[model samples]
Target: MRVGRGAREDRADARDIEWPPSARSPGPAGRAGAARALAAAGASRHRARDFAWPGAHGAEAGVSGCGRRNILLVIFDSLGEGALASMADALPVLSGLRREALRFAAAYAPSPEGGPARASLFTGLDIPVHGVWTDGVALPERETTVAQRLAACGWRTWLVGRRHLAGVSNWTTEHARPFEYAHLDWAHGPLHRSRQNAYLAWLQDRAPAAYAEIFPTQANADDTDCPDWQRAAMSALPDALSFNRWVGARSCELLASHGRDGPFFGIAGFVIGETMGAAPRQSSPCEALQERALRQADAALGDILRQLERSGLAETTALVVTAARGSVAEADTDAPMQESAIRVPLMIRSPGLAAGTVAQAVSTIDVAATLYALSRVPPPRRLQGAPLLATGPGSVGRGWALSRLRRDHGWKTALRHGRWKLVVSHGDPDAGVQPGFSLFDLREDPEESRDLAADQAHQGMLETMIDLMIDARVAMEDRTEPRIASF
Candidate 1:
């Protein structure tokens, strides 16, 4: 194994990482209340336990007899497809590793936002079944998440990063605090959104010095790098710099501490794009913030990789790095099904995967299903995502991927079947929708500038694609009824 300091370690010294000061110190009452709730739920003691050992508990133990393959799921919140591709030059570590990675050229998010996107990822089901199509919608407790299933099957599942996963809505159900190691129950900064308590708590548990340096104090809305167009107010907490750094270091610490005996599942989820707003305008100031954050994230990723190598876990670990949703939004465009909103980057690198070659039209929801299949774990009954690995390259015979949007003013749907993509808005479909259905032959117009839906020649193709999309939605909504797997 190559042993050396990773990019994350080097960057730690690059900033004046400090805790932001909180005007009103969090009183003992709040801490006491939190402690009482956690104690009642056994969460306090659970969070205190060690998690480094791979497949430490549950069904994962039985599946990974030798702990042969570890799954490292890395998510960059609200990342842009074009931006990640452009960073090949600035981020040498990722660039160097890209050749060994499986790039999904036309990968997409199941939904336009984080909660829905992540819900699809964790449940291995699309939004229709998971029903978490928006930020606040709670994932029903009765539904089983891929994390829960994997844990049940013997993989030590750990979720670390951002509060979206275990937010108030999802937290109230069994899916809430579902992971064995979760950084839960924290608030925004006191003054500006610069200070993040959750990030601090996580750091304190793993790398205390790094935490102290990054978050010197708490913050509030003004401290955040939130874009001016943001519909919601920013919270006071750790500044962006401190929050990101703390998240990176703590995640690495957790990875470093894993046991080497069995297969493990680790999700390093970061709220990259969503931190500022739902979708920042192209010319928004947050563009600079996104750019810098991506670079910082790239550095952090390098560090995590180095840690894995140092721990001698890289060889066996299956590393899958991707984004939750796109951060780019067109001006005057609230349609979530638009390419800029629904499309995201997907990259996977595993021991047995086809190295360096890009995969065709995969979706984020496929990750959980693929992992379940690889780990010999039975997925939840409601899961709609299938195994990407089994699909293989150029085998997306279905020709197109489906996307649905049902939140905010963004109500639309799309079908990406091969190079021909059709986007249709659900609102006012019959009132002679002019741009309601846009057809783009991606091979020729990858940017999706012109609308070819009016063309008579492609009408048949568009109709067929629409049928496929509707069928998919129907099939997904009927998940309570079991269907046989083609594979």
Candidate 2:
């Protein structure tokens, strides 16, 4: 149960804290509603009995006069569930939380990469509703974020770390103004500037030999074997140290100062995985180095936790550890869309959450709903994800998650429903790489080595799954038609 020694102290002193932007006060009626919502969500009455852990050091329901509960969401980029299991030796902090936190065995991302997945989380809408199909796609100004909704309800909301919203360029003053304390790495530069420059420098210095060793041929010259190639590629851009440190310190400060008065919303995101095809330490073949990067990221999370506990905000804080997306797995093969790229480790610990494991197929889109449900804020009606709090392990793994790739000719869409998945290459499958359907018994064939689409018995089932997937994609396209002007 004791995950780390003196890890608590290491957290409090890690960095300086920053408070969130204060908004107009909520009227008495709104406050009452918030209270009711919180109580209904079980935030106000989290007795030791609330936890499924029998021997846990239980505490009485503690709602500080501060008004609202605090949320510290830590999302690591490209950290997959398989990677967590593979690197279990290095990631003790995360593995340890399996006992106390609710683990969703089949957590999924609606999109394949950062932009669309994060867009889904923030807007509570599917890709089509938000119109943010990929990275750099702008979020329509009219759509609301979970943070924006909470802020409007009188909660001080500050967003720290990488800002990967699809449509940030057309930001408006009223709905999409800068977060109270916005921390982002625009590209790559200085500690507070570019992430690319640091990455390039790391590549040149830390593991220059690996860089030289991997980029021997032009076909793969652009593709380096070093695991941290993204980091090295990002060296040509900006630095995110101050932003990372600032966000961490500020989260603790905000939790301590605002936790007693009312609830606050804080989001701390990190791009721990490689951004480009190269980076020095991240590119090392040594599994120890790769794991160390992940563990350091975990340690950073521990720091944030220590701050909350130090300020007596631990029990009242809702801490969610997740990822925007997962890293590539099976580097030995050509497969990139397996469980590694889409499946992530999800750990949700809140006063309102019942401690246990949830084996249902959930997506990133559900995150906003969970936050709003816990904070007493109403989720935007347009959200596509369902509320997952307090839900028991589901028997139906019937829901499918969608992923898309923007190709030169057209867009490629993928639909994964439980054990069967279908990939449709819309633009030019006739040119050679046409759309394909892959079916596997995930429980029996976790590696996806066997393709069952050719099986006669599974033909009907595959067709049914493919039809459903195509229908979902069509629905998404139709939903975004009206939001074209918002951005």
Candidate 3:
């Protein structure tokens, strides 16, 4: 790995890097709160509004959008619109954040599976090009990740939770550099507690008492045979002390302690839908509990946000909260193009961006690009996404979203171009799915209940969308080709 600014681990860990400011001042709010607190306290003389970033009055403010030095990217593992809508009553903190942030109404995941979806989010590339198709696969070394790019731009980056983008097999790869990699399997639900190794270590560092009370038993447990995939209800530990509360609390601590050398970029992933399945599935008591998991996630988010405000970094940190993908069926495996996986909630709250809603079509691929753009860091030229907050002249973005799914039952390619959507299936007739064409007018049938493939009146519309899908596929193939053939 290339040597970066601070002291770094030869093994690619940011935590191993020490900050001089943190060593000098140990603030009470967090373990290393002095670093950021020094900056915040020293910069308090400049009176600025929420959108007016200090020392960035004209061109810098216009280009970078704000003077925010820290980025907090929060991901809820498996939360869909339906689940969020059901728990609206329980998510007051998130609801308040939604009102304070810029909400994307049509943000979609690049893939349905968590690993592949995270690959897209990190690389800003689709599944076919990135070559990370599912949970155990790593993003190819040839592709540079967002973390590497941000580090090159002088950001102190740390990943505090689930890192599905890097496969265990590719840990030796040099692409994911200048960022600490910490992975955690949530303590409840269908997740194997054995996979919560990273979290246990973090708990020992941050909350020794909680770790002492909930170890060995968890270490010796056989949670691998989870049948329902839902987490067991959390124990009596207060929300701040619970095992499920670690990532959020840890992120809060980081937000308070970061930016001694420069701005920090941290991602924290939470377990939300431990067992909620895809659409047309029956809802039971267990499913309700799964929804409660979202509430817990929201509470965790609140904890982080409250800390942000308390640390006086509230106006300067760009916060984004989203998900990898959500399941619609009882099982975790599902077609990527399904609405349950595609429809996700994305909210960005930063200093310059106004609190409003964007109704245009957008993809999770846009996430990395947007973050880089907001930080005023130049992204790699080949990344395949538009900045979600692109403004001024020539700020238009990709008006379509493409996804693919190769499942045990069948495989299909889909694209949402404008108001039309096309799903081209390759097999699975036994599962009531066939190799044929299915079209939907998303404006009239957002749920895709009506298939317009056979409607001759819209034959031309169907043809154009099919061609659009084909052209998109060709573009992906061009990017992914080993021989470098034109699409």
Cα lDDT listed for each candidate: 0.56, 0.54, 0.59
Ordered by lDDT, highest first, the candidates read 3, 1, 2
Candidate 2 regions with alpha-carbon error over 4 angstroms: 1-67, 166-247, 257-259, 276-290, 330-334, 394-398, 408-410, 427-432, 471-487
For candidate 3, lDDT tens digit of each residue in 84-129? 6656778998788767788876677776666678888888777877
lDDT of 3: 0.59
Q: How far is each candidate from the true structure, as Cα RMSD in Å? A: 18.5, 16.4, 17.7
lDDT of 1: 0.56
How close to the true structure is residue 289 of candidate 3, measured as C-alpha lDDT? 26
Off by over 4 Å in 1: 1-68, 166-175, 178-196, 200-241, 274-289, 329-335, 394-397, 428-435, 480-487
Question: What would the TM-scores of all predictions be?
Answer: 0.71, 0.67, 0.71
Q: Which run of 10 residues does model 1 get worst, by summed lDDT?
A: 14-23
Error of 3 at 336 (Å): 5.4
Better of 2 and 3 by TM-score: 3
lDDT of 1 by residue, 1-487 (tens): 1112223332222111111122122135432232233222222221121122234344344454433467888877676676666767887766766666777767788876667787887777778777786666777776777667766666677765653544332122213444634333232221123234455454466656644443455434333443443312222223444444445666788778888656678777655443432323333212222555556667777778889888888888888877777656443444455566667777778777786554356677777777765565545445556666655664422224677766234367777655567777755445544335666777678777777667655554454445545554554454344335876
